[model samples]
Target: MKVLVMKPQELHKLELLLPQDKIAKVIKKLGRQISEDYEDKDPILIGVLKGCVVFMADLVRSISVPIEMEFISASSYANGRTPEEKVDMSGGPEISIKGRHVLIVEGVVDSGRTVQTIIGQLRQKEPASIEIVTLLDKSKCRLVDIDIKYRGFDVGDDFVIGYGLDEAQKYRNLPFIGKVANE
Candidate 1:
């Protein structure tokens, strides 16, 4: 068997899905909703890196309510695009979650196994509430049930890249989301 490597330039050949302007509009709206919901309570936004880095940054700035930010590295696709049986996680928030509202921000959600695991772990810390906010939702690929309180866009099962979502650790810096061609 031989391995086929994709050239860097080929990554640029993507079909545009979510443009930058539209993404910004949706994020602003989500910010308003989240601010209103957590106005009286202190909410901690836990970002799932490294995909959530870009989305989380913009989202935090858009919200009117005061918020704390934390990050954890978790992935079901540790070695490849396809998810594995178990999710690998590390670097949880140092801040105590007990009695505080928690928001898990994700760049995209598919099988939901990883998010479910994160929720279970946080629940053990006894947060006042736990909610999910994802930039993109691929409901068609969901293998487990997860409630998302805030969502920026609903997408199909297409493999997307850009705006923090990567293809082979590339195309993450693109400002817009695009579907991988021939994927």
Candidate 2:
């Protein structure tokens, strides 16, 4: 399948939600908390690909603890704005997670289904523990119960983009988080 690339002006108007400086401050705090909690225990951070790229990169840098990084592909939004009935989950961490602490890093947690699915898959690997860390949490849109150990911010039901979040696989390069105004 071919992808359509449009000029920036053609995209929907965006309203700034989280500025870069603020996001950075919050991430630093989260990193400190995680570092303290997982002290001495080396943890593996598994990032959900496509969306989590930017956030995960920044978050990992802020973390003071020694952590192994990995990437996995898990998405409920294949193309459209609303989530599809079935979440597409693939890819696995190359490193062994057996008897090790695992932290799943996510850019956004909306329906909670994708995270749940990932946790279930990782459980099979016999990890000693598993936790979640998300940059944005859309708790109101959750269809299933999920515990987010670390959360940067909570947002309403606005279609958000930028800072690794995208619409039609676009706007991931935007430095700050924004809501599509006309969406």
Candidate 3:
């Protein structure tokens, strides 16, 4: 069997599906909303690393209000020993959330297991509130029900990549999200 690379048609299809400028515009609006909502409150932004670094950076720069940032890495997927499994916490940061508002920045919320674990663990720290902000939400893939406070995009199930998302660890630098084009 011969495997073909991406074609212009597939690229055009993806462009029609998701506009690059639109995505940026939505993110900027989300940032403004967060700033307005937390104008008087100082929230600790906990970025879920590896997956969310792209979204986190954009989100941090978008917010008008000052916010502190920390990282929390998790991977419940058992090292992909079983692709069907969910993500696990590789490890958490040393940031203190006690009595402080916490916002989790995430790239994708597929199974909801990663966020669930983070929330559960942070809840024990005595934080006043904990919320989530995800760039992409795939409702079809959610194994657990987790409420998201802010969302940039709610998209259908497709092996998406680019704009900080990678496939086989490549093409994350693409300006827009796209799938491996079938020829």
- Candidate 1 lDDT over 1-183, as tens digits, reads 212335556423577888999999999999999999999899999999989999999999999999999999998886567777799999898999999999999999989998999999999999999999999998898999999889888898888888999877877888989886674
Query: What residue pairs are clashing in model 2?
Result: none
What lDDT tens digits, residue by residue, belong to model 2 across residues 64-92? Answer: 98999999999999788887658898888
* lDDT measured at residue 142 in model 1 versus the true structure, 0 to 100: 92
How many Å off is the CA of 91 in candidate 2? 0.8
Whole-model lDDT values for every prediction? 0.89, 0.90, 0.74
Higher-ranked by lDDT: 1 or 2: 2
Which stretches of model 3 miss by more than 4 angstroms?
1-17, 76-83, 181-183
Who wins the lDDT comparison? 2
Structural similarity to truth (TM-score) of each candidate = 0.93, 0.94, 0.83
Give RMSD to native, each candidate: 4.3, 4.4, 4.7
Pitting candidate 1 against candidate 3, the one with the higher lDDT is 1
Worst 10-residue stretch by lDDT in candidate 1?
A: 1-10
Model 3, global lDDT: 0.74
lDDT score of residue 169 within candidate 3: 51
Instruction: Output the lDDT of residue 166, model 1.
Output: 86
